[model samples]
Target: MSDSLCESVDSTNETPSKKTQLEDGSDSLSVIKKAVVVLTRLPEYKISALRPPTPQQFYSEDESHSSSDSDMEWEPEGDSGDSDFSVPDNKQKTGKPTQNDTTKTLPPQTSTNNDSVSEPAPIIISSAFAYCANEITKVRPNLPEEEVKVDMMVLARKRHMRWQRGKIVEIITREDGRLKYKVNFVEKGKSLVSGHHIAFDTTPKLEQLYVGARVVVNCQDETFRPAILAELPSRKNRLRFLVFLDDHIPVYVGLPFLHLVCRPLENVLDDVPDSPHKSFMSRYLRDWPNPHLTQYKAGYILNAELNGVQQRCEVQEVDSSLIHVVFKDNQHKEWIHRGSIRLEHMARFWELRRVQDVSD
Candidate 1:
């Protein structure tokens, strides 16, 4: 029986070789039928000409100027080294050290004092010119012997906001033993600092000109129409002043937008106030100027003109040059020429007095 089973298995294997050949023949015939069907469906009509769409039809003005994500080119935002980890000079905030952070070593220490504590060199700011945070370093006139150890940021003049009278709100000591101050300005509040100085005297330089200081906004073209300094500039380099005509109307001016003339007082003693009263016009006028003249048109400022001399006017209404104004003598009249309006250089214009100078 075993022998008979073995013979049957051998016969079965020998007979199966034609089965694969039959399946291959069937697949070939199916492929041929599909090709014939596709050829019969080809269109007999001619196709229309194809052209790219016009830019005007497809794209709006804004879409053409802007780029899409797929079309944008990729580039590194900044360098991979210390630049990434470095803090801003105004407000230094360090990033955690990573493998990519550029490591920098502090400069070799020089001991300025007997104590072991490291002291950064003293930066002596020259008071020759009115200074704000960003102005370039000029030779600090008058003090040649003292070496001013300026902050690296100040030397670079990287911080450009000028705080003419910026007041220090807070002082911070950095981990690296550097000192930085937070300054605030009246015109533009809290900003970063690049340069700072310590004034020995609490009194401002402008305080000396009590009632007689005649000054103008240091405008371009010497249109230098006079504007009374309203208040001393903040510890930041900001200055606010006012323009007043005969009616004693006060128009406030802000800076660094309004550049006031800082040329040396031809006479330093001129700005000193003669009387206790703060208003410069009070000393001369028998009748106080009408305060109501201060109310101005929604867009137009009431300016005065005496001759052909014109000043920089920041008014919106420009149809006519002539505007009604009051004079120092308390006269109200309309001047034909806007250029003729004259701003007076009144001493102690705002009448601010130093605390120490006050008489009880």
Candidate 2:
């Protein structure tokens, strides 16, 4: 009985010791797990505390700097409070830099002076479809009816009839809901002051008029004034007029020159003389042709259209209305009517006059 009792006591003591050791081991394991978790979190906490917010974090700054102008000062005009400053959730996951993100810090901005402050809506200018294509009736003084109906058909049939290109200088709206425009015709050398409707033959592209474009200023006289397109000015109409090539001349730019500004001048010849017509003809013409062909020499140069192609030709033989000539390019002699051969001086005069008119 004594031996049995001693064994039972020893077993119970040993069991308690085993239980205490197990409990201690579990506590140590739990402590180690906690230490490992803390170590993982320490780097992230330190990095977040030390690093500054990236440019992508600020949506407003990113949007305003999209134009690459770091110094551009912009702010939400309204009082939206903290909403504008919030970073998007998707941006947090991606962490990629956007096109708008810039390194430069944005200055603190206040609200605009007025709540009404906002970007100006683009002005959509009307196209050629807006103008009236039909013929307009004009009143004549000292006439039987005091009114003349200029037929549109007759005007269309006439070759080289004046269809003056003009800009709407002023717009006036009538009580009848009809809009009238005051147009300044560059070719006509006059401004149509009253109820005249103007049309754009070719609409000017505002993007093309940006800096460093070669251009010409359309004038009423028989001279082409060349200029260079410069920085586009801030205008409500969005038309670029300010240029600095020759003397600062206000004139129309573009085909059928209308409006006041730089028009693109392509393929302008070098050393355009004081007299473009005289110089142009002097190069090809061995002898200038008189208006009446009855008084011209054999080797006269004539500007003629052969097979609908305008060319310089040398007169080989003159036979009344039929004159034999050879084209500068081709040696094959051909006969043309006297009317087909444009007189040298007359052709030059008209050519220079047209150049001044179109400013091309």
Lowest-lDDT window of 10 residues in candidate 2?
Answer: 152-161
Segments of candidate 1 deviating more than 4 angstroms: 1-216, 222-227, 231-240, 244-252, 257-280, 283-360
**lDDT of each residue in 168-266, candidate 2, tens digit only:** 455566898755445555555434232212222343344333333344434456343444333233211123243332332223233333222221123
Error of 1 at 91 (Å): 56
The alpha-carbon lDDT assigned to residue 190 of candidate 1 equals 59
What does candidate 1's lDDT look like per residue over 1-360, in tens digits? Answer: 231122112121222222223564563222211111112222223111123455433654322221210111122233422111111122223323322112222222354434344422111111111123222121112322222232311111112211233455656778987555555543455544422222111222332322223333323342223333322332211234333322233434443323222232444223333422224344222221111011111122222334433322222221111234443333534332122214211111112223325752
Candidate with maximal TM-score: 1
Error of 2 at 77 (Å): 36
TM-score for model 2?
Answer: 0.17
Model 2 steric clash pairs: 253-263
Superposed on all Cα atoms, the candidates' RMSDs to the truth, in angstroms, are: 29.7, 30.2
Q: How far is 37's C-alpha from truth in model 2 (Å)?
A: 51
Over all chains combined, what TM-score does candidate 1 have?
Answer: 0.18
